[model samples]
Target: MVDKADKTAKVAPAKVKGGKKTSPAEFIRQVQTEGRKVVWPTWPETVRISIFVFIMMIILSLFFLGVDSAFGAVVSWLLTLA
Candidate 1:
């Protein structure tokens, strides 16, 4: 069972074995390949995301503004009562 478990464990590739180092060009190519595999948002998807973020920002701003105004009014009213 222990031997079977060891064999089933995922192992990292020994890319840098024996102190062999990666060159800058090889690193850049690896990065480019990984970037190509990324799922980039389409133009329409990006626009929709931006609009959703903008609307949420506006709503939260208004909510905080109202709360601040209410607190200020309460403080002013307390000062008048004194």
Candidate 2:
């Protein structure tokens, strides 16, 4: 029977073989090809996302303010009992 250590041994990822370096023109061409694949958002979509983020920020801040106030009041009342 195999030992537990042998059964659970880690295997390393294969290393990439070194290949020929790409020329500068080829690199630029590849970059342009990749750039064409990107899909950028329009102005209205960006504005909507920004507005949503701001609303969430305000709502969360009000929630935390309420929680902090409640905890402070409870601690103050407990101190008075001592």
Candidate 3:
């Protein structure tokens, strides 16, 4: 089955006469049409997403800090024993 999105993704070659290139206006119009079809997130939704990601980063940072301190202490104790 052919999907609508896949169909829209394809573009045929522009017609050329006497080796002349296509105009920029046609290219910009095509891009704007495609841009309109995209779905964008709302500001409130974006803020919620940002907060969730920030919290996750803080949690992971604390975890790695604890693991690093434990390793450093063990290495210092082993050097003193030598």
Candidate 4:
């Protein structure tokens, strides 16, 4: 039977076989290659996203303001009853 203790045990990170390190130039080259693979949004897409974000922010702020005002009124009325 498989041991439950072994199933729950944490595995350690594997060590480098030869302890070889990458040079700074090689690291920068790898970074540039990875950066090139990234897809960036166009100007119109960016502007549309920014407008959508601002609209949602205004809507959420108004919603929270109404909710806070209702709660404040309820608490104020409750205090008067005591």
- CA-lDDT, candidates in order: 0.94, 0.93, 0.92, 0.94
| Residue pairs in clash, model 3 | none
lDDT of 1 by residue, 30-52 (tens): 99999999998999999999999
Error of 2 at 32 (Å): 7.2
Report the C-alpha lDDT of model 4 over 1-82, residue by residue, as the tens digit: 9999999999986654466677789889989999999999999999999999999999999999999999999999999999
lDDT of 1 at 53: 100
TM-score of each: 0.60, 0.63, 0.57, 0.72
For model 1, what is the alpha-carbon lDDT of residue 57? 100
Alpha-carbon runs more than 4 Å astray in model 4: 1-7, 14-23
Q: Give one digit per residue, the lDDT tens place, for model 3 in 36-76.
A: 99999999999999999999999999999999999999999
Which is the better candidate, 1 or 2, if ranked by TM-score?
2
Number of the top-ranking candidate, with lDDT as the measure: 1
Which residue runs of candidate 1 sit more than 4 Å off their true CA positions? Answer: 1-21, 75-82
The lDDT of model 1 is 0.94
Q: What is the lDDT ranking, best to worst?
A: 1, 4, 2, 3
- Give lDDT for model 4: 0.94
